[model samples]
Target: MNKNQPTRPDGTRDFSPEVMAKRNYILQTIRAVYQRYGFLPLETPAMENLDVLTGKYGDEGDQLIFKILNSGDFLKDLPADAVTSMGSKKMASKIAGKALRYDLTVPFARYVVMNRGTLTFPFKRYQIQPVWRGDRPQKGRYREFYQCDADVVGTDSLLCEAEIILMINEVLGKLGVQNFQVKINHRQILNGIAEAIGAMDKFSDICVGIDKLDKIGLDKVMQELADRGVSGESIAQLKPILAFEGNLQEKLTYLTTLFENSPNGQKGLADMRAITQMLNSFAQAKDFPTDLHIDFDLTLARGLSYYTGAIFEVKVEGVQVGSISGGGRYDDLTGAFGVPDLPGVGFSFGIDRLYDALEELNLFPAEATVATQILMIGFDEASFAYCLPYLYELRQAGFATELYPTVEKKIKKPMSYANNRGIPFAVLAGSDEMQVGEFSVKNMLSGEQQRVKAGELKTFFATK
Candidate 1:
C-alpha cells in the first residue's frame, strides 16, 4: 500500500455528499415511518463481547463476524505449544474477546436485558446504524452497511407481527417503491415441513438448503438437500410444499392440509392465517393502497436460527437484487442475556440495497441530488460583502445556499461552477444590484433571469 495512494477498504465505501443525500432520503423515510408507529429511536455500540454475538446467528453467520484482536500483546501469555497446535478458530477465541456487531437485533436484545429493570414492557424502538460482516463483497452485499431496524420487544402478541408487516408496507410505499412484495413465512412451518417429510432431526439442514431455492433454483436446492444426507423420500415429499404457489388464502388452505399430521406445521399455518386475516382486515378498514402486496411464501426460510415464528422478506418485483429487507419474530432472544420470556418482532431495511433499487428505478426525488438550491455570485469585493447578509438570510430561511468564495472569480466561472454542480439558481450581486438592494436571480436550469428585491429573495426561491 503506497502512502500517496488513496483507497477505501475493499468491502467498504465512501459516501460522497450526493450519494449521502440520497442515502439520507431513504433513511429519513424509514425513520419517519418508524416514528409514526410509536417506536422510539435507540442506538447501540458498534462492538460487543465476542461471546455475545458468537452463537446467535447460526454457524455460517458466526464465520462472517469481524473479530477484533485483543489489544496490548494478546499472545504474550499464551503457551508456545498451544499456539503452534491449536487451530486458528480455537486460537482466535483465546486471543480476541470483542467483535464488531453483525446485526442490530442481538445488540438490541442485549440492551433490553441490561435495561430491563428501568424500561417499560412492550418496548418499541428503532435503530439506524451500520453493521459489519466479513462476507465477500458484491453488487448488493457489503462488509459495511446500514440496517434500519424497528422492533417491539417484551410482548408476544400477533398484533406486533401484523404491525411490523404494515410498517414495512408503509415505509416502502412512502419511498415510492412501486413493485415489491412482502413474503411471510414461519419457522414452525419450516419445521413442520421437515417433519412432514420425515426429516425431523435435519431441520436446520433442510432449512439451510431450502433457503437457497430462490438463488440456486429448485434442482440445486434439492441436490443440496440430498448432499446434506436428507433421504430421497423426504425430498420427494418436500418438493410440492416448496413449489406451492397461490394467493395467501389458497396457499394457507393447501398448507393446512399438507401439515395436517404435523403439530408444528399446523400451528405455523394457524399463525400465518391469523396474521394474514388481520392484515387483510386492517387494509380493508383503512382502505390501504393497492401497491402493497402481501403473500404467504412457505419457502421463505430466513436462515437465521433466532426466528422462532413469523419471518418476513421484501423483494423488488422486477429486479434481480437480493431481499431489500428481512426480519422475524424471536420468542426468547433476550433469554440468552438473562431476560427470558421477552419476545420481540422486527424488520431491517437494507439501506444500501434499497438505494440501489431506487436509483435503478429513478425514484429519488429531484431535490435529493441537488447540493445547493441557490448560489450567490459576487462580481467584486464590495458586491461580495453586500451579498453576505442575503446569503445568510437565504440559508436562515431554509434554502441550501452558498456564496462564491472569491470575489475575483469571473461571472462565467461561477455560472459554470453552479451549472456543473446542479445548482438550480444563482443570485448575481454585482455593484449595480448591490447599490439598489436588488439582485438578479438566474435560473440555472432554464437560463432565465428575474429581478427580485433583496428582502424578497427567500420568498422567490421558496416559490420556485
Candidate 2:
C-alpha cells in the first residue's frame, strides 16, 4: 500500500456495521415517507460538466466544489505560459471539463432538462446519494457525504411546499427527533433587502454574508454586509427585522411594512402567509407538530442564489452545528439547462449532520446488528455440505443465513464467532442429526436447543 496516498480526508468518516444499520433505518423510513406522497426515485452521475455546476452556486459554493483531475495523459498539451499565469481555474477549464457534483439539486436540474421529453410534468423524485466537496472537514461536516432529497419540478404551487414541510415533519417524527424547529425564509424576502436598499446588484454578495448570520451573529453579519459595499441605509433597514423578536405573525407584520415598496418582497410575504394558512389547515386536521414554527429573520439568507422562493432550514434547540436540512424553490434552474420555466422546490437532509443530531440527542433506536440468523456450524467436512441445503431452505424462508466456512476453527471458535456477531440462532448439524433426518436448532439468545426435521427448517424460521 502507498503510505503517502493515505486513507480518507478529515471531516469524512466510514460507517461501520452498527452505525450503518441505524443510518439505513433512517434512510428507509424517509424514503417510505417520500414514496407515500408519490415521489419517485431518481439518480444522476456523481460527476457532471464543470460549467453545469460553477456559477449556479455562487463564489463560496464554487470554492467548495471538488474538481476531478483529468485522466489518460490528457494534460500533455499544457502551455507553459498559460499554466504559470492562469493557475487552477484557467488550467482546469482546458483540462478538466467535469467535476464531482457538489449537490444533488444542480445535477437533478440538468437531468430534468435533458430528459424533459421522456418524463411527465410535476416530476417528483427522491435521490439518496453521496456528494463530494473540498471544504474543510469538521464535526458533522464532511468532505464527502450523502444527501437524501425530495423535490417537485414543473410547478410552483404553495401546496407543494406545504406537503414537503409536512413530509419533513413526518420523517423527523418517525426518526424519533422530538425537539427541533424548521426555520423557514424566502429568497424573495432575502432579495427584498437588496431591493429595499438598492443593493440588488450585489445580491450574491449580500446572500453570502447573511448566510453566515447563524455562524457570525448579527453585528458581524451587518459588518460583513457593509464590507461587501452595502450602504449604511441598507444595513439599517435590516436591523429591525434581524432584531425583531416575536411570533411569526408579529415578524410578518413588521416585514410587510418594511418591504411594502418591493413587489418581490411582498410576493414572498404572501407565499409565507399562504404556507402559514396551510399549516393552520394541517393543525386543524391534527397533521403537524405544534412546535414547527417559522422564524423570519432578515438574516436567514440561504447561501445558494438559485433559491427563487421559499427557503427552509431545520435545526434543534441546543445544538451548535449548522442546519441539518435546507433547500428552497428555484424557478429558473431548468432555464439554465435550456428547459425554461421548470420550477423546482426541494430539501436535502444532510446525512452527516442529521446523524450528529440524533447522536447528540441520544435518539438512535437500540441497535439491531447485522448478525446472521443462522450460522450452520460445520462439525466436520460433510456436515457443511449436509447443512448447505438446510441453509438454502432457511434463507429462502427469509432468514439471513451463513456457514462457518473453516474447520481449522473448532466448534468453540464458531460459537464464539456467533457470539461476537450477535447471531441469535445456530444450526448445529452433526453426522448423527444428518442420518436421523434432524438438526439441532440452537437459540443463541435464550440458550435453548431443539431438534428440527430437515423439511421443517424453513417453517421454523418462517414462523420465527
lDDT for every model?
0.88, 0.83
* Candidate 2 lDDT tens digits, 119-192: 99888999999998888876666788899999999888898888878887888888888777788888888777
lDDT of 1 by residue, 1-464 (tens): 78799778879999999899999989888999899999999999999999999988878889999999999999987789876699888888989999999999899988888888899988999999999999999877889988899899888889988988888888888888878889889999998888889999899998888888888999999999999999999999999888887887787788788788999999898888788777778877656766457777888898747889999999988766789999999888788777778888888898888888888888999877767888999899898899999989999999989998987555888888898888889999888897788999998878899889999998887887
lDDT of 2 at 232: 90
Report the C-alpha displacement of residue 74, candidate 1, in angstroms: 4.5
Error of 1 at 381 (Å): 2.1
* lDDT value, residue 335 of candidate 1: 84
- Lowest summed-lDDT stretch of 10 residues in model 2? 286-295
Tell me model 2's lDDT, rounded to 2 decimals. Answer: 0.83
* Candidate 2 runs further than 4 Å off: 1-6, 9-12, 79-82, 85-87, 193-206, 229-237, 283-298, 367-370, 453-455, 459-464
